[model samples]
Target: MAAKKSEYTCIKDNTIQNISRKTAELEARADYKDKRIDEINHNMEIMNNKLDQVLNSFNDLKLQSTSDDKELELRLKAIETKLAAQEKTTEDNKARSDRIIAIVSVILAALTFYFNYMH
Candidate 1:
């Protein structure tokens, strides 16, 4: 009977020690997981800040591009107006040249008729 009691006590002590060791291991794993989660959250917050900065820079660039486009459009319109004015001047010069030629032809014809009659 004494041997049986000692054996049971030893078994119970071993079981209790094993449970305590397992609980310690679980607590260590939980602490490690929590630390890893905190690091991940910190990194995510840094990434979000960087993204916002990029978005702001992009918006600034977009505004600059729109202004540049408007300036280009105005320059093109001025060039078109100048070209139209040059075309009108060319047409007017051509018409003047035709009129001068017609007048010279009439003067020549009158001189020929007068010379023939006087002779």
Candidate 2:
């Protein structure tokens, strides 16, 4: 009976050692997984910051493009206005020339008629 009891005690000790070993392995795996999660979170933060910078750059470029486009549109409108004014001035000068020519022609016709009647 004493020999049987010693045998049982040995078996129990081995089982406890096995359990402890398994527990240690599980703990190590859990720690490694936690460290990996932390690294992933850090990398994610860096990526988010980079993405934010890119978005800000895009926004600035968009604003500058919009401002440049507006300025170009204004310049085009001013050019169009100047062209219209030049066209109107040209038309007015032509009308004045036409009136002067008509008056000169009438005066010449009247002079010719008077001279012919006198002769």
Candidate 3:
């Protein structure tokens, strides 16, 4: 009976030691997981900052494009107005010249007819 009792004590001691080693391994794994989570969080924050900068740049470009478009429109309208005025002036000049030419041609015709008849 005493021998059996000693054998049971030895088995109990071995089981306790195994349980302690497993517990330590679990704690180490938990520590490693915690470190990994921290790293992921820091990387995410960096990405967010970069994204914000990119968005701001895009917005600035959009505003600049709008301003440039407006300036171009105003310039185009001014040029069109000047072209219209120039066309009108050219038409007026052409009409005046045509009248002068017709009047001269009629007077020459009258002078030729008079000279022929008097001869």
Candidate 4:
């Protein structure tokens, strides 16, 4: 009876140790998984912040481009107006020069006829 009891005690101790080791391993895995999840959440927050900053910068650039386009359009319109006025002025001058030449020719022809037939 004494020899049997010793052998049974030895088996019970080994079984208890194995059960405790397995429980501890499972707890460690749970803790490691929770920590990894927290890390992923933290990284996602950082990425969101960076993405918001980029979107804001893009909006600023779009506004600047729109303002620049309006300014360029105004400048182009001013140039076109100036060119049109210059063209009109040139046409007026040509018409005035034509009238002057016609009057001068009539005066010269009258002088030539009077000198030959009367004087």
Each model's TM-score? Answer: 0.73, 0.69, 0.77, 0.66
Task: Say which prediction, candidate 3 or candidate 4, comes out ahead on lDDT.
Answer: 3
Candidate 4 regions with alpha-carbon error over 4 angstroms: 1-16, 101-119
lDDT of each: 0.93, 0.95, 0.93, 0.92
RMSD of 4: 4.0
Give the winner by lDDT.
Answer: 2
lDDT of 3 by residue, 82-113 (tens): 99999999999999999999999999988898
Overall local distance difference test of candidate 4: 0.92
**Candidate 3 deviant stretches above 4 angstroms:** 1-10
- Per-prediction count of colliding residue pairs? 0, 0, 0, 0
Candidate 1 or 4, higher lDDT?
A: 1
The lDDT-based order of candidates, best leading, equals: 2, 1, 3, 4
**Model 1 ranges with Cα > 4 A deviation:** 1-11, 108-119
Candidate 1, residues 11-87, lDDT tens digits: the string is 48878999999999999999999999999999999999999999999999999999999999999999999999999
Question: For model 1, what is the C-alpha lDDT against the true structure?
Answer: 0.93
When 1 and 3 are scored with TM-score, the better candidate is: 3
lDDT of 1 at 82: 100
Question: Per-residue error at 112 for model 3, in Å?
Answer: 3.1
As for lDDT, the candidate ahead, 2 or 3, is 2
**Clash pairs (backbone) in predicted model 2:** none
Residue-by-residue lDDT tens digits, candidate 2, 20-93: 99999999999999999999999999999999999999999999999999999999999999999999999999
> What is the TM-score of candidate 1?
0.73
